[model samples]
Target: MSRLSLFAPDNFPLIQPGQPLLPAIVDALTQGGQPLADNDILVLAQKIVSKSENRFIDLGDIVATDEARDYAARCLKEPRFIQAVLNESAAVVRCVPNVFIVQHKLGFTLANAGIDQSNIDPSCINEEHRELALLLPQDPDASAAALRRQIRDTLGVNVGVVISDSFGRPWRLGTTGVCIGCAGVEPIRDQRGQKDLYGRTLQVTMPAIGDEMAAAACLLMGEASEGRPIAVLRGLEVIEADLPATALLRAGNEDLFR
Candidate 1:
């Protein structure tokens, strides 16, 4: 029998900069009878990854440029934070009165490159204690690899790790977490040549299992919830010794949408 369980941490303390997330997760899992089994996937929220990597921005210290001020006025965002977002974005793809779409350097089409201000501390508004907002990690793949190595070395267990962030789908209303980085698990499984129950040939069948797991985890790890930055997904079939999320991305020439 295959089963899936979502683990949400209970009243966990705020994760400070330089704090290790894997150890915190290990402690939580240990308290919960170590729910991770072989082939299990650990779906992690990218906010925590960014926090650990010191990817936060202080809104008080920024000097908004003319373009940034214009963007801030249009987007209704803090001028400093909007400037930072602009600096991080490769190009501004779309812009409206309060909505701006940007293509990040990492080739992700997202709103403001996922810079958020909803969950941060509002009290910290002074120069010394500026409000913090998360920036996307410079290299999400490397972050996943380092975390995977730490987990293997510390827990003596082999499992898959996924670093995920909330992203809006094209022509979709809401946002869901998608796998930006992954390790030790196949991100996609191609079943194009397989036969269905009706004996019909299947074509172009590929499952984005990594993104699926990320969305599932994000359900429990709510955008506003305190703690619960990690979730464990069990009972997934393992087909590779080393798997990376890049495999899920289609080449520009191969993509029909492109």
Candidate 2:
């Protein structure tokens, strides 16, 4: 049996717009007394990354079009907010009261294009940025790669990075954490053609490892007010790989639901 250790910083500082995430992570790790270890997987909440990237939207700057207004009327949401979602989305998947699902520009089919209204820094919510909405990073995979590179270049230790976000699943009641971006991590472990204990060969035995880790990290990084946005997972068997989270997504030919 293999054992995995997870560590979280109790005092991981609250991130602000334009904050350098590396320094904050380093400080948290220092305070926690867990220096960077080889093969360690760093799981990060996507909100902090967006915060560091200053990916907040000022509602006042959004101009709603006819389509946005129509969707807002049906969803009972603010027109500007809907417009912002439309701007972030590639296409609308569904629109209903309290639910506006769309395919994000980054190809994630999630509610509101994964644009979150909760947990936004209140200080940035002012007259200029009315009812601030936090957006996903422009390029999450690139963000993860950059962070991984920075960790290696800065600390001389190679670690995996996974950027996580909450996602609602079909026929599922609540949201769970999923990997939106990753670097130096194996997104999927394809077990096809592998033999089982009974010597039976597996055909489609792929598991999303990155998403599994992200879900575990979210257990510590709670949905509401847990304040732990970063966690370290050590002892994963394949923590050092050159794969991104996009590898987990099903292509058009492989997608059965579409």
Candidate 3:
């Protein structure tokens, strides 16, 4: 690719559950005079997608198990929140006071199982349900694929879609965006057998293109209330294959840090 560009349309109404997100995206693009182009990549914040899919939980509805309560006490967090995290995790990875990390059911090593309570409209939440949290979509790959198809049908343009979330690494001081779901793009680009500039054979050089793209788009969509949930990445190379974000997960056997 010669050049890359990323921009978020500045106008969009608050997203709601069960709403057709594609049509609204198209509308916002048109309203901002920025129509979809071929090979354009649409990066969406995971919060909006989860909200649209109605992946919400009321803390009052949770019945914390003994294990959850114990972890909550150790982590100095609420038992209901700990229960939610346990429900979404496959295994507990790390824990400390005010910090709890787990291997998400989807294979991502995420903090608090990616449960979030920020940027949600208070009106949509029930008054009694003060501890409402939004969970990640059940299947982000499927969500991305369905959204891509809808975009294609609406605008007749075959574009890529990436569902991104912010994540903090073990040693990293700050958080950056990561692709939890992607469609119409290669999540990992394998270049193990490729030759270097000096004609030397390369080994173990696979790049996470989806994560890179998501991080680039996140520059425009800030962590705080930027009000820009969708970003369009232009001039990206796209592959017409089912490359899901699951490919980015490191196998348990390959994880040396653990």
Candidates 1 and 3 compared: the better one by TM-score is: 3
Total clashing pairs in model 2: 0
- Computed on alpha carbons, the lDDT of every model, listed in order, comes to 0.77, 0.89, 0.90
Report residue 34 deviation for candidate 3 (angstroms). 1.1
The candidate maximizing lDDT is 3
Model 1 steric clash pairs: none
Better of 2 and 3 by TM-score: 3
- Give the TM-score comparing model 1 with the true structure, all chains together: 0.88
TM-score of each: 0.88, 0.96, 0.97
Least accurate 10 contiguous residues by lDDT in model 1: 118-127
Q: Which is superior by lDDT, 2 or 3?
A: 3
**Model 2: per-residue lDDT, tens digit, 1-258?**
989988888867888889899999998998789987899999999999999999988887889999999999999999999999999988898998988999887878899888888888766646455578899999999999999999999999989999999999998799999999999899899899999999999988998998999999988878888889999999988646677788888765677987
Per-residue C-alpha lDDT of model 1 across residues 1-258, encoded as one tens digit per residue? 776676766655566666788777877787877655667788887877877777777766678999988888887876787788888888887767778788777767789878876666544334576567878878887788888788778777788888989888777799998998888877788889999999899997898888888899888887776567788877667665466766766665676764
Q: List candidate 1 stretches off by more than 4 Å.
A: 122-127, 241-243, 250-258
For residue 107, model 1's alpha carbon misses the true position, in angstroms, by 1.7
